[model samples]
Target: MRTRFAPSPTGPLHLGHAYSVLLAHDMAQAAGGTFLLRIEDIDQSRARPEWEALIYEDLRWLGLDWEAPVMRQSERLPAYRAALETLWSRGLLYPCSCTRRDIQDAVSAPQEGAEPSVGPDGLVYPGTCRPEAPPQGPMPDRAVLRLDMARALSVLDAPLRHEETGRGPGGETGQIAIPGDSLLRAAGDVVLARRDMGTSYHLSVVVDDAEQRVSHVVRGEDLFEATPIHVLLQRLLGFTSPIYHHHRLIRDAAGKRLAKRDDARAIRTYRDEGLTPADIRAKVGL
Candidate 1:
């Protein structure tokens, strides 16, 4: 029942973030399980020290308590490198040199009702790097590393399953079992590591969660689609799968999901405007 709230220090925490943190903390507390916090500051270009400091202050002001000495991903580059090396040795990874335009052109050119599979960031790569021979030598400049989706699927001996218990957007509590095919098709050949930062979200998150021995992952439902990719990576990397709970997202009056760019919804702005933690909780209907 252990759960964690891993936040990146790219921007100020927002109402959307508060919902996720409070949800994870509440679930852990109710089950008498440990609560942990991990700083997902892998995007060095965008991550800032001041933003990270604000994360701590905001979460503390919310009356949330996490295990001391928080885990920081910036300090764990070696671990991610080890994972990339393992995947490379197994031939599960290939270096990609295609830019965004190249991928879009491939996807748009006569695919016949091909419904694109969106990643967590909402981009569906069109497998431009799925070549017959794996590239040799050092990775290409500005090259990205993509997982061999077809090969990964072949190794999956059986369908994976995860149980989730929560109220749907309609407000009915129920359980659902996720199927393997649905996950595999939607998570087609996701990027494991990118040359820009040397690692992508999928690779770093799965590795960190396993290293921390997280028992449960509770977050916004938008990420539910990416769970299968994480699960597949876990199986490949020899890590145990943690239970998942994808809760509802906190949206604005226009029904759009709140983001860091929504300065009006930023947690710090709310705090400055004299909004209490209880006020945030009630606003999000948590």
Candidate 2:
């Protein structure tokens, strides 16, 4: 029943973030399980000291507590690198140099009447830099690494599946079986390591969860679509899958989802307005 509230300290916490943390904390407390506060500061380019401090302040203001010596992604680079190397050794990873525009152009160009379609991870990678053979030797600097989805699936000894307590965009729930063709179309050649950041969210997240021994994953429903990819990575790396609970998102007034850029809904803004912890809990319908 171990749960975690992992937040990237790239900006101020918002109502949506408040809802997620509160839900995760409550779930852990109810089960008498461990509740961890993980700082996902992998995006070093945008991560800041002040923002990290604000995350602590906001969580305390929300009346929550977590285990000490909170885990920070930046400090776990070695672990992530090890996992990437394991996949690389298995001939699962390949270097990619394509930008967003390059992927769009390739996908846009007709190929056997297969029209370009968007996937869970946004525009399914066109595999512009995917080499016909698995790369060997040292990984290149400043080059993104992408998973070979087809090869990864084919290597699986058993069918990949995950238990979903929350519904997906298409209202899928219960135990979901991951088919080879579907995953390739939904999240083709997903990036494992970024060109600049050295590690991407998917790789870090899966590795972090396994290391933390998280038994349940409580997060926003918006991430439901990406669960299969995470499950695939977990299986590929010989890690156990955690029960997934994707709660509903806290959207804005116009039915838009809250984002880091939406300072109007930031927890700091509400605190400055003299709102109490109870008020925030009620506002988020906790």
Candidate 3:
């Protein structure tokens, strides 16, 4: 019964983040399980030392404590690279040169019966790099590596299933079995390594969760649609899928998801306004 509160040190913690951390901490304490803190600073371009410090400060202010020294993703680049190499060796990864704009253009162009060409991971990759025959052409000068969903799924012994204790946007809950085709269509050829960063959220998260032996994954419901891709990656990499709890999001008055940019909702701002930990819990309906 191990749980974690993995937050990116890109901005100040908001009410939504506080809710997530509190929920995870409470669950672990109730079960007498371990609680861990992981700093997801993989996107170093946006990560800040001050932001990381603020995360610790905010969590401590919230009366949440976890085993440490905390794990930081930047320190684990070598491990992520190794995982990518392993997938590359197994022929489950291919270099993709398509950028967001290119994919948008390709998806926007009308094709007969394309079903609107949308996916959970943005516009379903148009497969611009797919070769017509074996021995695909030379890799592009600048390309990110993507998992070949079909090839990865081929090695699975059975269909993928995961336990869900929380609801999805469409009210999906309970044990869910993911069909191979549906999985691919929803998250087509998701990137494993970015051209600039060398690793991606999906690949790094799967590896980290397995390494940390997390028994339950608790996060915002907006990420529920991406769970199938995570489950698929877990199976492909021979790792266990953690029980998931996609809690409802903390939104603003207009129903907009709270973001780092929303400084008014930031925990630090509330603290500055003289709000106590108990007040925060009540405000978030914990």
Against the true structure, whose TM-score is highest? 2
The 0-to-1 C-alpha lDDT of every candidate, in the order given, reads 0.81, 0.91, 0.87
112-180, model 3: which lDDT tens digit per residue? 857645666677887787543322444333359888888888878898988998888887789988889
Stretches > 4 Å off in candidate 2: 112-114
Question: Model 2 — which ten-residue stretch has the worst lDDT?
Answer: 164-173
Task: Report the Cα lDDT for residue 30, model 3.
Answer: 97
lDDT of 2 by residue, 8-89 (tens): 9899999999999999999999999989989999999999999999999999999999987899999998898899889999
What tens-digit string does per-residue lDDT give for candidate 1 at 62-173?
9999998899988888898889888877777787778888877777787688766665655577777777765566544445888887777677776665555654345433
Clashes of each: 0, 0, 0
Residue 15, model 2: Cα distance from true site in angstroms: 0.6
Clashing pairs in 1: none
**Once superposed on the true structure, which residue ranges of model 3 sit more than 4 Å away at CA?**
113-115, 132-142
TM-score per candidate = 0.90, 0.96, 0.94
lDDT of 3 at 4: 95
